[model samples]
Target: MKDPVDILSALADPTRLGAIRLLWDGEEHCVCELMRKLGASQSRMSRHMATLKVAGLVIDRRDAQWVRYRRNPALSPAVAAVVDAALALPVTEKAEEIAA
Candidate 1:
């Protein structure tokens, strides 16, 4: 398991938070999809995904020429609760707002 601080630190970034939300449904999303939704450049989206991967909040697999990411399946109950709670909050602005 990753250190809690490292995981929390990764979540502290709004860009990462947004990406996490995108994967909250447990569905895998291609890097291009995330970029399109967030109106971000490929480099920026990939950078944040890399951060989530390091923190163990997400997993990535190469799908042909694309990379797809999904929320980590082995989250501790407490960590899962935190993620759920965060996602439950009403979005005053789309998280993608920060992604751009």
Candidate 2:
């Protein structure tokens, strides 16, 4: 079986962690919202998002031309625990600025 720590490690990236934090706070967000919030390019955000999806930390839904992401509530207990821990961290300045 794949190690859950590996999944957590994938989320440890600042960019990916920011994405997850945004989803946790907002429940769901679109690519554009994330791009603006993180001040990251579409390609960069997409790559991070794809990693999160592959790690099972987030899930995607399509709405017309937009793709929305949310924390995967059904994630494995270990993965969920990691997410919980991450959410408890001090929100980054960029995240806070965007959240305001």
Candidate 3:
């Protein structure tokens, strides 16, 4: 909300970055899928997504029992560029391990 720095800082964590990377594909994903992808517990994933919401990086919708998320359509170009750059980097060890 303050600046691009705030968005970048929110993504500084492994889990948050990974979550954003998954959403960058342009499809909405439920919290359950995010938890599975990131190898995080439900509460942990919720917290990370909450951080994303507060930073204006993602948008969410509730579908009965599920909550789905996607990259915020209204995201600033500068902030979107930062997310794109972060995802372009090689996968982190933790990410690889989780995928494996």
Candidate 4:
């Protein structure tokens, strides 16, 4: 598990939170797919993903021209619980407000 502060900080952003919600299903998602769903530019989406990666909340793999992302499966039990709790929370309108 990463520093609790770092993990929590990563989830503070609406964009990253949106990405996490999309990934909560445990399915691999291409960057392009996330970009389309979130209405974010490629660079912005990638940058936010980098933050999530640094926080150890997500892992990625290069796939030819695109990168696929998924929630980190190896999170410590405590961290996993935190993430699960966050995901379980009902979505608010503010959380769905991803900037263009």
lDDT, residue 91, model 4: 77
- What C-alpha lDDT do the candidate models reach, one value each? 0.84, 0.80, 0.87, 0.90
User: What's model 1's lDDT at 52?
Assistant: 86
Clashing pairs in 4: none
Overall local distance difference test of candidate 4: 0.90
Weakest 10 consecutive residues, lDDT, candidate 1? 91-100
- Write one digit per residue (lDDT tens) for candidate 3, span 1-100: 4476778788888889888988998899999999998899988989999999989999999999889999999877877888898888998797677544
- What TM-score would you give candidate 3 relative to the actual structure? 0.90
TM-score of 4: 0.92
C-alpha positional error of residue 60 in candidate 1 after TM-score superposition, expressed in Å: 0.6
Tens digit of per-residue lDDT, candidate 2, span 1-100: 2467768776677878778878876388999999988778888889989988888778899999889999887877766777889778888776566455
Worst 10 residues of 3 by lDDT: 1-10
Top TM-score hit: 4
**Model 2, residue pairs in steric clash:** none
Error of 3 at 33 (Å): 0.4
What does candidate 4's lDDT look like per residue over 1-100, in tens digits? 4889999999888889899989988899999999998888999999999999999999999999999999998988898888888878887787766633
Could you arrange the candidates by lDDT from highest to lowest? 4, 3, 1, 2
TM-score of each: 0.85, 0.79, 0.90, 0.92
- Residue 16, candidate 1: alpha-carbon lDDT: 77
